[model samples]
Target: MQLLLLVDNNDRAFLSDINLYKNEQGKFIPRNQCIKLKDTQGREISLLSHIDNSDLYGAIFTKFTVVSSSRFINETVILRGTNKHGQDVFLGLLLDKYEFRSFLDKEDELCLFISDLDEICIFLNNNNYLGSGLINERSDKQLFIDLKNNMVKLKPKMNHKEKFCTSFRFFNKDNIMVNSIIIPVELSNIGATNTTTVTLK
Candidate 1:
């Protein structure tokens, strides 16, 4: 698998060599991987020298395990992963939906296009999936994707203390059903604080 990390609107870094191993559940997951930055001339470049105290850099380099992923019809994907520090980091990837499906045909050759790293972290941290960064803030609803079933669902902006429940079906690429997962989301807004809680049912 390939991981393309975009440094900015203009600069990018590519990690072409990645190792993936299946977990106990038989799902393929990326191993601990590091990125090597290079210029157009194939010369090594220092990523740290380009930016200081970058949350995007730390999130990408830190050891993390992907927990959940959601994709939109507009070819955008939101990934949630938990780092070694027990912090949930969010990443936004931009790629054609059809291209992503093609990647599913060849799981080992999947290429991930990650962009707007910093903004994704900030927006998702605040429980705002539809934010002004990589994800379209103009969107009226939040998106949820079932990768196994190739399905997508949307939820309207919730009022304070609103509760919502949804069922997600999981399947493998071969169209074999694995399991069904039910998620209950609660949105609580009190005094100046907004909190979103997700629980499995």
Candidate 2:
């Protein structure tokens, strides 16, 4: 089956195993096959499998968007992946509020919520630009702090805070590079103005 490995920010192997089915009340409940591993923050990570290897990789390779919402936080993230059909894969899902910042690391290594090599490869292979609208609705101050910390760890050269939408773009036609975040703003009298840009390099 397709395995979803959970890793720390350093890309180290955290948990590895497959998903198995157990008979329960005349039905089947899927269970994990490996032990849990703690990341740098002492958060437990696990490996999960949904389908067979053939289909798992293919589904994840599709481009998608990730949306995280909670009683106090709400945000959206978009990402793209590579697939065998020549059509880029796009994935979108909602994640736990604190989970996004679980991989923040200023050191030599960055942690990952998913550690499966195959899945990671597929995700990195099919890359594209993503954007986000206003984020003033977030009521979780801690979540914002953690997210800001994670952004710092990402090594963004320039970051801007504005009441507008922002998006990321990648220009790695020849070599792999970081995607940049762009923002467009409108002044009170002016038509439209462009504010600061966050370059991920």
Candidate 3:
């Protein structure tokens, strides 16, 4: 496995100058790999790492040594790691709304979701980009995948106020009932935290 430190906005050069090693706290320590001390026989020895789940391919970036910035809060850093198959994956550690998980249907596919939508549209052109959904129930995972398929067509529902709020789903080709995400605009009064619990049927 190999690790790379990216410049966040765009893919940039690899940082190979900083020295790093595992510490007792499980975080990588820069410029300090080992410590010298006396062993049982009074002979000088090194006290090395004893932390579990230490990543060998991970790195430590000291502010003055790695970057000139005093803090990393404003900086966007992406850590890219490659597996044995030579496929690379990147993570924006400090970026908001950035998450990647294995696909619910296929192992080869990765599911990436960005979940911030105001209201459901009246009529969405088929194959258009739909917002993200968070499956609340355990059994809803497969239901979500089957409903959110590309072959399905979903339309909004007209509520008591004569407003199109909720969405009902149907198949595009076959009459088979395929599942999809539905949002009720009435109950969608989300708080300032910007969190919504989605239900899948």
Candidate 4:
């Protein structure tokens, strides 16, 4: 069992459970169930549903943090987690810009919709992005958000070379392309004070 923390554009946070099951391949996978959380009124509101091809691939984390942000030109879903396999996973979704600015500017309440498979698609006021990853380990995980370039990077606190896997997607009104790769990242002094910490047992 793992926990997923969802932070909406309004900065309201919701926590939900992520159930895992063993697949025919003898690997653990997350069930594609609708993620719901209660609002201040105690009404159950659906945050994410119709999740297709939900696969964690045995990458279990104590906790997962997801943050959704909409800027002038782009909407992003940032996922951060360190799995039990001693690997850091960073997933980001970059979608068409200005799609949600009108609604956001008006302070209208918007529901979040996430779909697709390995490439997770997130929707806000009918906009979407592809992202996936697991978060775990230490409490001092640092993340750098480069709004100018529409990128989010994790800076680990460990000293050795760590296995860092990333999948980032850029989607526009005309073109859609996804790049997924696993690379090793060197750990060094993290100077970014803006961070999110996930402490695992």
C-alpha lDDT score of every prediction, in listed order:
0.32, 0.28, 0.24, 0.32
| TM-score of model 2 vs. true structure | 0.24
Which pairs of residues collide in candidate 4? 73-97, 81-134, 81-135, 82-135, 82-136
**Per-residue lDDT of model 4, residues 151-195, tens digit only:** 323223333233333332333222333322222233233358634
Give per-residue CA lDDT, model 2, range 68-149, as digits (tens): 2221132333334433334433322223333322322112122133443332221211011121112233322322332332
Residue range 28-103, candidate 3, lDDT tens digits: 3333222111222422221122211112122322211000011111111223343223333232221111111111
Best by TM-score: 1
> Candidates' TM-scores?
0.29, 0.24, 0.18, 0.27
When 2 and 3 are scored with TM-score, the better candidate is 2
Clashing pairs in 3: 147-179, 147-180, 157-166
State the lDDT of candidate 1 residue by residue for 114-201, as single tens digits. Answer: 3322312121222222211122231111323322122222222334235656544433334354444455644444355433333222
> RMSD of each candidate?
13.6, 15.7, 19.3, 18.0
Error of 3 at 54 (Å): 11
